[model samples]
Target: MRNGKTIEEKIFKILTGVACYSLIAILGYIIFIIFRKGFSYLTIEMITQLPTGGYYYGGEGGVLNAIAGSLYIAGGATLIALILGVPAALYINSHLIRHKKTQNTVRYILDSLWGIPSIVYGAFGFTLMIWLGMSASLMAGIITVAFLITPIVIRSFDEVLSTIPKGLHEASLALGSTRSQTAFKVLLKQGFSGLITAVLLAFGRGIGDAASVLFTAGYTDLIPTNLDEPAATLPLSIFFQLSSPIPAVRERAYAAAAILTIIVLIISLSARFFAKRYSKSNLK
Candidate 1:
């Protein structure tokens, strides 16, 4: 019996290690490929200048418009998601804390939404845009991406808030504090790191998702100055460029992919740093 148990443990441990290393190896290979193919083409000109008339045909222009547009759309979407998600998450963990069934139902629905394909959101956004007599533009993309990521924000924050001790809530109420006060003053502070992490995760998702913005963003070569103007994004830029028959254009697609990967890496690192800092501060 003892020997069997030891063999089982060893097998599981080996499997887990294999799985972990496999993921790491895959990620490393992806990064390697992107940089290896893109580093030569990822010039300052590509970062600074807008696409020339023949840019897609291996012309002398950069993807600055796409970069700026991606930032604008993702930033706006994240802001909207944060505004809506935080309150919903707080309500679930605070106001509905006692109603396990309701909380589970809400979370299940959110999880289902999260599993839906980005392309579906894009299609729905396109339909809604036509219904509202709105053209595909930065505003439409922002709204669509916001809808895609809000469930993620709510669920991530709710999971963090749920980990908190219920005793704290009871104690606060016992001390004559209102539920609202306890939620904002105590729970919010305790879960600050998680909130930041959730927001950053949602931002990363919004920025990287091409399918969700494909129809709604309506690509343009120029940076959009208004919400009503069409926008370009890195993912879409990569998609279009990679589809080109020109070898140069294909290489530039890899470069664009590299840029997108770097942005996501930055967001991920920022999340970790902020989460750690706030967690330590909360401890102090």
Candidate 2:
């Protein structure tokens, strides 16, 4: 029996290792392919210039418009999500701490929402816009993306808050602090680094989601100057370019993907660095 158990353990370990290496291999292959196929097209001018007339048809122009537009939508969406999500998360942890059933219900709902396909959100947003007599605009896209990421942000932060020692909460309350005050002063402070990481993760999701913004953020050749204007995003930009029959335009698609990958990697690393810094400072 001991030998059988040992064999089972070894088998599980082997499976886990295989899974981990497989994931790394897949990711590495994807990155290598994108860089290999697109490196030559990733010129400074390609990033710095906006699309001119017939740019999609092998004309002169860069992806500056898409880059700026993506930043605008992602940033706006993340801000909105933070505004709504953090409070909800705090309430669930602090106000509903005793109501495990209710808290579970809320979390289940959030998980369900997070599991919903991005295209569903896009369609819902599209329908709402039609009902309100609104056009496809950056604001619409931002709202859709915000809806997509809010659940993620809330759930993520809630997990972080859950990890805090109950002693902290009890101590804060014993010191005559109100629940709200304790939540903001003690709980939030303790979880700030994790919350930032949550925000960054949500921001990455918002930035990468193409289906959610497909119908809301209309494709534009120029940077959106206002919230109500049409915009473009990197995912959609890559999708559009890849759909082109022209070889050069297809190559540009790979370049766009590479840019998107780089942006996500940079932001993730920056989030990790800041999280570490904040965690250390908070500990002190």
* lDDT of every model, 2 decimals: 0.91, 0.90
Off by over 4 Å in 2: 1-23, 274-284
**Distance from true location, Cα of 134 in model 1, Å:** 0.3
lDDT of 1: 0.91
Looking at candidate 2, the ten consecutive residues that score lowest on lDDT are 275-284
Regions of model 1 farther than 4 Å from truth: 1-24
lDDT of 1 at 152: 94
Q: How does model 1 score by TM-score? A: 0.90
Clashes of 2: 0
Report the Cα RMSD per candidate.
Answer: 2.8, 2.7
Clashes of each: 0, 0
lDDT for 210 in candidate 1 is 98
Could you estimate the TM-score for every candidate? 0.90, 0.90
Error of 2 at 281 (Å): 4.8
